[model samples]
Target: MNTFHLGLIINPLAGLGGTAALKGSDGVAQEALALGAEPRAAERTRIALECLRPVAERVTFLTFPGPMGADLLAQLGFAHQVLGSLENGATCADDTRQAMRLLQEIGCALILFAGGDGTARDICAAAREGQPVLGIPAGVKIHSGVYAISPRAAGELTRRLVEGGLVRLASGEVRDLDEAALRQGKVSARWYGELTVPEEGGFMQHVKQAGMESEELVLVDLADWLRDSWEEGVRYVFGPGSTLHGLAANLSLHTTLLGVDVIENGQVIAHDVTERELFNLVDGYPARLLVTAIGGQGHIIGRGNQQISPRVLRAIGLEHLRVVASKRKLGTLEGRPLLVDSGDPLLDDTFPDAVRVWAGYREELLYPVGWGS
Candidate 1:
């Protein structure tokens, strides 16, 4: 039996800044960990790998030492060969680049990595031209178009390649955000390069449409509608996005542009909160979640706002949730359903098939919703 070689690299420190409310984890992994932020890369990689279990005997994984890859592969009892080594402590971009070089040298059929856009940038910088790679969405700033819609989708896509199924390869743009400017309420995305990726639109995500859309008037109308329709005692858990930022401005509340914020009675009760903080704030209170879909991506959950976690979403009943997006942004989807990948399959399944999107004043469109995987 000819075995397919799969390369795996896990950026253990990726996404630490998300739940810690630090915006992006580019230079603040330690700070995020200090704030009690737990790393989600390994667990997300595990989920992706779980889909490959049935064909395990047909696939051989080439991976780096310890937390980068081997550790989780061992935990899952997957047959994998460990390569290279790390000196100590926290891993850096150089380590990811090094792993990329090693994987490329070994001629693995496909390189699977888990992390955010920064990690993608490192991989892109070190990659040999036309080297096939795929990303598992495990990072905070996932503006890149190279990643799968979700971890399971990544696994499923890889499985197709291993099983000799028909899969088209295409160039995917690697994009990253400027963390400094992002923290200052600015959304700046730059195209780093491109990677050879599996061309499956349903399984892969489009690059995030950075900054606000051109329809400023629509945003104003939506904000005014929300301001007027605000319930008296309900706490609104606002997820990150320029649409919500505009809404916050109308209420004169300074909300985080890339972090979750909670407001009550037209005032911000909590500014830039973590997952735990958000859960605690609305665990037993009248709460509603207000989120906007990523332009061109149609992701209302699980992209940048990991803080509106499964528990938080469950606590704020699905019926109480709200979505806001411009008609132009909705048109970017080209008829695809809005996506939700809260990391819990059961919770994801409970979401309504279609959600009521507030596109303008007194205008509501029932948009279809789909699981990210």
Candidate 2:
């Protein structure tokens, strides 16, 4: 097997400097508490590091000093080769370039960083023809194809690559989006060229649910089943996706097509509920979570709704919850697996040994819950 050196960088404020939207967390420091927004980046880096722990034995991890990447790795009891020179206050963006240059000089096979779209551009600045990199989706607005579906997905993909999982490497595009236009509630997409993205399994594109015309009828039938099978006296916390939104359309109610919804037996109790609100809804009404994997990415939880905290998941229990995906959607997953963020990290730790994800009514597929080994 060929071993690769993966350099880890955390652009502490890359996404924060963008527009005042919630997707950009770096600028959040100026808007909120003086905690410097370190916790967000720190926690994400920690999550990324935690996922990489089991794979530690498979690859060489090259890293920078404190706050850059080293501190988080050390805290997790992970050993890595420190790449560049380390010094004071860990001046944010300055160190990102320095760390990237050092990784290139050291001949690292790939670089994995965590941040938003700006961080992706930063990598694009120094990325070469054959250099491969991956991003742990931590930034507020990660409208880029360079990112792994989720933090754990990033780790799983890295693990698969190290295990000689026949993977293809290709040049993936890096997009340049207009932050101001997006802030003005407009969509303006521009090309920013391509970077070498290691072609591997499980990495997905967020698209308008694919294979639409063919699966339209099945989707329609699935929607009817969901609305009809809804339990009485129990609340339904529907995560974002067209499939979940289908139930709302059938119920003669409006829902957030791209957000979480809390519904009662027949009415829309609340729309665009957050992770916190979802938990409260479940507690107050005794409910189950109904979610579907993102069309391209095999993620059922932890994509857009950070409001569904871990505390709520434990209260509702995954045993009572249901995961729905169209047959076409399941095919794209390619056995990559499903993920749940559940605000609290520990909940994903204790999920069921296996879950029969509902691909459609009378259609189910069995997949494991926990497997870091």
Candidate 3:
């Protein structure tokens, strides 16, 4: 029987423990709940495994115990080998790290981890000695090519690796983003290294480096307009991306690239808001939603940010919404109307109608927020 040796690690609190402005979930007992940072590590683990269902029989899931890693696999019926015995509940980064080290000591061929930048760093530090590595991208700022384009893509790459398919080993850039700067909506970069990443899986994008490129300038200008145009007592719910951060820069506030932020009356009310946080913030205070179109992928909402639930969007109302983007950015989407993925099937009907986007100083284009499939 052909078999492939694979290791797994899930940083249970890795991405879920961020310091969103609403209440820095990081290290805060109460605030973490307030921000609604769902314990996504488990869900991510399940998603990755489900994606690899086709080749499950040929793979061994050498992983941590319980909440640390194995629970997700167990939930999805993965009866592979579990490593690192634990006396108490293993539900943290320390536990995951220990399991990863143990996997290395046993000479596992590849380390597949579910996390954002923090998880990526640990994998680089522990497995850099030519051990193959890949990421599930369960973090907010996953500025790393080591990750597959999505959880499903990550599984596809793993299947190829196990099958000994033409999975060429290429150097995927590992980029870490400053959390502090992330809140301020600016991306600072440092090259981590080229880890052995399998190609042919569209699970990555070249980390968007901070620069004053033409596209960036266009975003900066649009942000300036919103900052200057915003009125007091009005709420501003920010979506993820450099374009959204451009608006934050003008206000001298911070933004998270892959998370949601809420602002009001020239003051930041919240950062890294989840679906629940978004609703509470909107209902408690009237606000406007400012978002940008996803680059290359025609997504206005839902694709990457499944957190923006439809209930929240309905409460905020599209009448008070605004879209910002560069004309070129929209053009790259090539007429594929923006998509919405709010987890609610009804959102497909109530999504904004031909919202006007300020692509340039005077060049305005009406884009359909969602198109019928």
Candidate 4:
């Protein structure tokens, strides 16, 4: 039997800007740090490794030194080889590139990296043709098709690849947005490059689509259902998205397009609220969270709407959480589960095996939800 050699690389600053609402972590590490943004890439990588525990004995891990990769594996008790060195503080793109080159030189069968689209681009630049790479998503904007839908999904795919299962190698797009433009509420995306990814249906994400015309009717139907099902004196916390915005429109209420809002009795109680403000509002009333998944990405939480923090989710509880998405958006996932990364691992596991999503008026779909690392 041949031993499976997997290379690991982690960009420590991958998702530091998410909850801070800075949009992207590319060049705003210092700003995000000043705003008290914590490093999440390593923790997210640990989630993937936890899922890989079943197959750990059959694999050897090659990783970079310190916070980049080796430290997490060591803590997990996985026997791994540290391939390169880095300074004590702050690992840069060059470190990722160097680690990739070294891993390639040592003939790693696959490389499992933790970061966002920017990290994906760095790996793509260093990877040779036919080299299979997988991404554990831990970024603010993950529009790329090269990542698993969630960290557990990443581990599942990694296990399948190492176990000699029927896995297909496919070319995946690496896309990134201009961080500056994103902070300004303007979406400016560009194709960085392509990477060879290990693909298994329902495990990896598809590239996000621009817009869908058919979703309008579905949104109106869902909005109608919400209007009919309205409970008296119950407060509704609306998450940021076009879907929820349309729902607000149906109620003839105003909403922030990309900011969290509070609605009561079909009226806007608060608009463009922050995390603290959301907590304050939900505490005194019967509240429920209303959110939609990122089309094609399949994330219901912890992507763009970080305003609904884990603290808020816990206060609202899982039963009070409601998800709405069009059938078209669900179809883009190809049966992948809806994802949530509230930045709290314990809170993430509190969710049930599946949750019900309102696809249209009187139409419900039971979809599985996973914690995206």
For candidate 4, the clash count comes to 0
TM-score of each: 0.54, 0.49, 0.49, 0.54
Model 1, 1-373: lDDT tens per residue?
2456789999999999999988989899989999999989999999999999888997779998888999999999988999888897458899999999988776676789999999999999999875778999999989899999999999998876564333456778999989999999998889999987875533212223443445677777877887888899999999998889987886678998999999999899999999999999999999989899998888898999999999999899887777887656776776566889999999887775456577677665545577786
Cα deviation of 185, candidate 4, in Å: 2.4
- The regions of model 3 sitting more than 4 angstroms off are 17-30, 85-93, 184-186, 201-373
Candidate 4 all-Cα RMSD: 21.7
Collision pairs in model 2: 16-26, 16-27, 23-140, 275-307, 275-308, 276-307, 310-344
What are the per-residue Cα lDDT tens digits for candidate 3 across 106-159?
A: 655567888887677667766645456778877766778899888888887776
- Candidate 4's C-alpha runs over 4 A off are 201-373
State which candidate, 2 or 4, has the greater TM-score: 4
Task: Give RMSD (Å) of candidate 3 vs. truth.
Answer: 22.7
Q: What tens-digit string does per-residue lDDT give for candidate 4 at 95-135? A: 98888888877766578999998899899888886566899
Sorting all predicted structures by lDDT, with the top scorer first, yields 1, 4, 3, 2
Candidate order (TM-score): 1, 4, 3, 2
Model 2 bad stretches (over 4 Å): 1-3, 14-29, 32-38, 85-87, 184-186, 202-373
What is candidate 4's CA lDDT for residue 96?
Answer: 89
Q: Highest lDDT: which candidate? A: 1
Model 3 residue 111 lDDT score: 75
